[model samples]
Target: MAGGRAPRVLILLCILHLHCLQGAKILTISFVGGSHYLLMDDISQILQDNGHDVRMFYQGYQNMQGYEKTSVPYAVSTYNMEEKYLKAYDELFHEYQREIFISRDRPQSLFPLMTLYAKHCRLYMNQTDILDFLKQENYDIAIVDPFNPCHFLIVEKLGIPYIAFFAGPFSYSLGNGLPSPPSYVPMYLSGFTDRMNFLERVINTFMYLGSYMVEIRNEEIFSGVIEEHFPPDSRPTLSDLYNKAELWIYNMDFSIEFPRPLLPHIQCISGLRAKPPKSLSQDLEDFIAESGDSGFILVTLGPIISAVYRMDFIKEMNSAFASVPQKIIWQFKVSQWPKDLKPAPNLRLLDWVNQNDLLGHPKIRLLVAHGGLNGLTEAVYHGVPVLGIPLFADQPDNIVRIKAKHMGEYIPFYEIKSDKFANMIQKLIKDKSYKMAAMKQSVIMRSRPFPPDQQLLGWVEHIIRSGGGGHLRPYSYQQPWYQQLLLDVILFIFSCVALLIYIIVKVIRFLIHLLYSRKKQKQN
Candidate 1:
């Protein structure tokens, strides 16, 4: 394996070296937390590894796990947010997540999240010193996490080109002018399959319209920040700034996701951070060995959702894991675990897990996840089936795709019980079909003509070399909705046809009246 990889490694370096300038300074922004920042961190590291002077600006709401300046190869700068914003974020999300989402009827969550991100935009713009420092960096281009529009606002202020980095399935491209036909394409968080029935299609259409409504609300949320920071005449509209991205790098792959139309400017670099399994620690290895032929299950509900893990939920999961023969390696922090409940005999709970590396283990039978894109992508790369218990945001929507692909099944959090949860786990592990499906998806994932890193390095350098990706973007981006969809032209044709028919009918009636009058006079 090492021998075969050497040539490909050298070729990749040569390809990247061709575009390598005298160390082009690249700036990356991460305004959101969790997997969003993780994706940017990996991207920044890749660029730095390829000899670019990469720097990451990290700030997040309420200091969630994975929000800290993680150990990465690139330089990182930090900005502290005010206590008021942190307090507000805590009060809002904790209550909302517990009360609304925990109820599990798919309540409206877009507006609340948007409102929080908008507040962060205001907070980000208030950092005059950071803005001035960024202006002096003179970066060739910036990579913005479009999750928070403020990330782009900073890049716009610096007056450099930027690429939008989407962390997948949150439907950022829809409002940013991707051609999403509602008939078959499902909206983010709608939880409908790509192949939809008539009722599903109707709901999908409304969900598409709801996306526009969300965008409008998002604009309203951020209008204050733009007004306060940018000058009147020089102010940029939200749509223009969103569409201004030279390229879009999505954390999505067609193998796991439904096939959809994408532009040349858009690229999928899913599972770019994945690596083969490393040797497990002695204790963990011993535990896996005890499971013997059954292997083990890896479970993580993400950092945010795990913090809210209820004791009853943990007990139920524990009972289910006990019922299974497969040893469970669950990523549960011991500090937050309830004193009343003990872990099952077959399970081992760890505070921190090397998830990607663990997924690639030789004996990894299944992954039990919260359906986050990062985890799911790793599962796809490792050819491991998943049993998703989705909670909030894109989690539910993501699991829908997972189940649709036949790699795994999902049990709604509110509906999870010991019996049903154990059955699903056994089905995913015992059934060879799910494993076969997962391996097939992995083949598709790895079958891309060029690896994701090459695609990233290649496209990023091409964009910088050409100053921007404006040439790659289609001309349809500049057209208004009426012209782009040809709605006005259709209306014009319809009206003209109607008018011609009306005129023809009127002419025929008049001729018939004249003929009748002539016939009456002759008869008299």
Candidate 2:
């Protein structure tokens, strides 16, 4: 009877332990498409795996964004945004790309697209039903994509504590009292790495200051939405909302990115997506095997680029691929390929390839890419070297880091000559050091004390269980800009030193005059 009682007591204790750790309700928001949705979806999936109820809300202009998530474990709410503004923005971008490649002009700051962004925000707030569902649900915490200022507004309206999942560089966190020294930390769109000379540093500093101007413009973009939807008395600036985020998990890993200063609340989750790849499809296997010992290059210019970019770019790429001895697996649209041009003999054009799987294949020589963070992270994980033909966005600087690390090289979009492109590919294939460097980075990425998935899961749960990450936040956010920078303290010290020097000069002058006067009187 005593033994039976002991077993029952153990069962009760186990039940009690399970009851103590209840799963927290999490709401994730993703309004932007592509990588933004991918990151947020992954976050929601992970939370659900841990027995939490996760609801992901997606609103965007792009229709084709979320279809890739075929096995989502979380509940999702989606809203299709009006595309009137996006159509106009696309026209401007199309023209902008034309100007850069056709005119042989130097690259400049991209179009602001403020109107397009603002319109999306307005449309998103107009979703009364979705907003009502979110409000009724009463989520414990919200994980938002700060890419669209609209998601921030939604979270603010709901009055829930939030975290950020960002794909941009560290410079974006500058406004939130995060340390972003311009000397090393490059501007988000500057396309520069940490290592810069005197002139580059000057440019980087100016670009850093220019980011504030861009933020001011971003505020202007969202001002109308706030005025139209929210109460007049409590207008929340997008910049202010960005500052209040309890934690930020970037879609970046140190394996590819340069090291920079990050706070306790700020962390990177790049290594989480790096998985041991599965086998490719049978057709893909046959294509990869055709290269034999020579190997094949994997080219994916991202989904958007393949569809929008002109045929001249394709022609140049094709000409280059034709020159190389190795086979090429290029991710491009079959429908977009012009019938007038002859396809490269060694090239296989696929609408989609298991990019991660291809990168993991032993025969993958080097990745011919646009230098997006996702593919770069995968390449580093699999120890595959990259050679990027950077088109736009952060691709230039992303490639800059790859070149700096000596694991890869980058060619400007305007400079894709057949001979030069082919030569670069040959160099990468022949060079053993690039492969070694990539492998070293892979080892570093996987060899962390705690793997990236554990870090991501632990920190998020830590925040959820504690109600918020208020304890991890530094008191610096509450301080004024001058105080945060220690500008006032600097001025005080400078003023005291100046006063002391002034007094010393005055005393010395007076003493000198008195001595001279006495000496002159004696002489007289």
Candidate 3:
């Protein structure tokens, strides 16, 4: 009886072992902006909660403090960009910001800055310690933020299947080979809506082509970096690695994003970061209570922007806030406040605030933001209208979408006159339409088929269980450019028709000539 029981126990142990092995070992790569890190952290958290073993490799220039309490195991590498590269980056960032404010168009030259970042990422990945650690780790799948193309190569070198994780709306590079006709699906940086006139469509088409060319150039830059870090003979090309991705998870939703075609493997986990409103701090609560029926406004430009340094902008904002009846909570990051610049008595300045929590508060009437994706999503989640002060990158496009939805209005930084700013704020607060539209979008955004976390985890598990879901990848991705566009087929059909018409004309000419010759002979 003891021996029979031991045999049954062994069978039970084997079953337990199989169940444990079913849990995937996931590796996540995140870099650069705070927003990107936040999105990746959310994903890592969900993956780990579902019993998978998740590890992350994070490298960023700033905002490392945000991930201090994360449970997922991680190896962090900082570029130490502050020591040497900060000045250059600051100059570029502000310059680009100014350009966007003035022109409200895509920056003329982003390739230089892109290549600079690529070089830094390549340098970090080539470190002996990082390389060895990554090589030893056994991972079933890699979820990468493809903001830097170098990450794709890193996953490829480790011989793991990967999924592209974008922190914002699907851009041109990520949406490549996916059907996003420019006529309807606006270009990433074009700042156009889905509803476009003929001129806008023509511009969208050109912008699409231009963006593609830039991607090609950047790919070439990344290819050289790959060759330097890995063996040239056996390594795959950048395009090959890009096409090899098993899935794509975009931090976007149809509610806030333009409708476009997408592959089955692509998923949208838009408001995953949004949570139920938490109780405000004692001081915050007191401030809101003091405001009474007037409510309060929240102003933040996010992590990268140096809003404190822009004295002129600050003065204009101060003037505008002074005229308003509502109290204000401004997240300004300066050590010493300028004595000469007097803010409104109703304004309260702090170094940081829990933006999501503040947005959810019932007493908070308006959000003044840099039009970042995370901020916009949070505002939409809480049904709060925004007064957009767009600076650069996707900010313009975000504001355009807000206006189209009638959820808000935007004032470019360069055009921020005190009266105009004040009036916009007043319009947002007094008008019920903006609030109604925001609530409508919030409803749509929250009405996902499944909770965002569950959706994210389910898709990730699907990829691992299905062995990278290679069958879901579009065949068009593997085809030549002409063939994928059907230009070759169109050309073939046109040639055949032209040849048939030519042959008919020749036959008719010959018959007419013969008849004319016979008639002349009969006359003779």
Most lDDT-accurate candidate: 1
Leading candidate by TM-score: 1
TM-score of each: 0.91, 0.90, 0.90
Native-vs-model 3 lDDT?
A: 0.78
Q: List per-prediction Cα lDDT, in the order shown.
A: 0.83, 0.79, 0.78
For model 3, the superposed segments whose C-alpha errors exceed 4 Å read 1-22, 64-82, 85-108, 173-175, 304-308, 521-524
Clashing pairs in 1: none
Residue 512, model 3: lDDT of 99
lDDT of 1 by residue, 412-500 (tens): 77778999899989988899999999999999998889888888888888888877998878898788878987999999999999999
- Candidate 3, 327: how far from true, in Å? 1.6
Tens-place lDDT per residue, model 2, 216-312, is 7777778889999889789888877887888977877777788888888888887556688898888888977988899999998875555566667
Q: What's every prediction's RMSD, in angstroms? A: 5.9, 4.2, 4.2
* Backbone atom clashes (below 3 Å) for every candidate: 0, 0, 0
Report the C-alpha displacement of residue 186, candidate 1, in angstroms.
1.1
The TM-score-based order of candidates, best leading, equals: 1, 3, 2
